[model samples]
Target: MIRIMERIALDDDELHEDFMRSSGAGGQNVNKVETAVQLRFDVRGSPNLPEGVRGRLERLAGRRLTKDGVLVLTAQRFRTQERNRADALERLVEMVREAAVPPPPPRRPTRPTLGSKKRRLEGKRIRGDVKAMRGRVEGD
Candidate 1:
């Protein structure tokens, strides 16, 4: 089981991992070894996550999420498959941890204060007067 937060723990079975060949910097070993790890988690179908967390996870995943609400994370930063696998799982745990936090309250709409409004209008009037003074004098 993976603990995402104080209240959230995910079973190992919830995650699916696939290993594939890693590109770059491995030389001869890179072609023969499948060091890259791809981790998939079904956010929509998970029984472990709260509804709010599920929704936030989907939103935060963005392009990494599929239409079916599966989140795909790839980790290939390490040369060894074990390291990459751990990295992928770590990323998934971090994402779930982030999702566990409640979203901030929605911003309340507010109108400008009377004093601020008055100041804005006063500034505009001053700007207008300055521009008006640039015009040619009628009597000249």
Candidate 2:
């Protein structure tokens, strides 16, 4: 099981991995060896995810998510297959971990305090005075 948080954990069977040729920096190995890892997770079908978390995960997945609700993550930063695979898995875990957290409560609308309103008006008055002084001098 892949633990996202204390309560949220995903079974290993939920994840599907595919190996493909990696682009850049591997010389001939890049063409021959399938070092890149593609990790896919079914967000919509998973029983492990809560409804809130599922929705959040789908949003977080963005373009990586397919119409079928599978999240695809590609990892080719590392040259070795093992590192790339681990990287893909780590990315998935991080994404799910982020989704597991609850969103903050909506901010309540607040009116300016009387003291702040007075201060703002005072500053505006002072600015107007400064601007008035800059007008054409009568003695000039």
Candidate 3:
């Protein structure tokens, strides 16, 4: 099981990994070896995640989240399959850990202070005056 937080733990079966040939650098090894790791996690169907965390994970996944609600992460930075696999898993854990945190409270709407509003208007007027002075002098 992978521990995301004190309350959240994911089973190993929750994660699915696939190996494919990695692109770039390695030359002959790149052509012959399947080093890239693709990690897929079912955010919607997972029994391990809380409903709120699941929703946040889905949002955080963004384009990585598929239409079927699977979060797909590909790791190809490393040359070895083991490193790439570990990288993918580590990324998944980080993502889940992020989702575990509660969102901040919604901000309350606030009106501009009278002093600030006056200052803003004053600044605008000053800017207009400066721009007006830049125009060609009518009597020059």
Candidate 4:
């Protein structure tokens, strides 16, 4: 099981990984060995994820998720396949963990504090005075 949040765990089968030749930096080995990793998770069809969590994941996935609801992560920063694979999993875990939390509740309307009201009125008065100063001088 893949641990996301404290109570949330994703099944191993829900994730798919593929490896391909990594480009740049490693020279000959980079050309021969498959060091890049691609990880895909089907957020919509997964039985491991709850409906609410899946919905949140879809919204949070942004460009990583495909139209069919597959979340794809590519890891090519590392030279080795194992390290790249680990990096991919870490990213997936972080994304799901972030998706697990609900957004904060909206704030309720409240009356301004007495001090705040006074400060606002003072600011308005100052602005008014500045504007009044710009008016044409009387009889001049």
TM for every model, in the order presented, reads 0.77, 0.87, 0.77, 0.80
lDDT of each: 0.93, 0.94, 0.94, 0.91
Candidate 3 per-residue lDDT, tens place, 1-140, comes to: 88878998999998999999999899899999999999999999999989999999999999999999999999999999999999999999999999889989999999999999999999999999999899776885
Model 1 Cα lDDT, one tens digit per residue, 68-123: 99999999999999999999998888888888889789999999999999999999
Better of 2 and 4 by lDDT: 2
Query: Clashing residue pairs, candidate 3?
Result: none
> Positional deviation of 52 in candidate 2, in angstroms?
0.5
Q: For each of the candidates, give the backbone clash count.
A: 0, 0, 0, 0
C-alpha lDDT of residue 118 in model 1: 97
lDDT of 1: 0.93
Better of 1 and 3 by lDDT: 3
Q: Could you tell me the TM-score of candidate 4?
A: 0.80
Q: Which ten residues in a row have the lowest lDDT in candidate 3?
A: 131-140
Where model 2 places Cα greater than 4 Å from the true spot, the runs are 130-140
- Scored by Cα lDDT, where does model 4 land? 0.91
Best by TM-score: 2
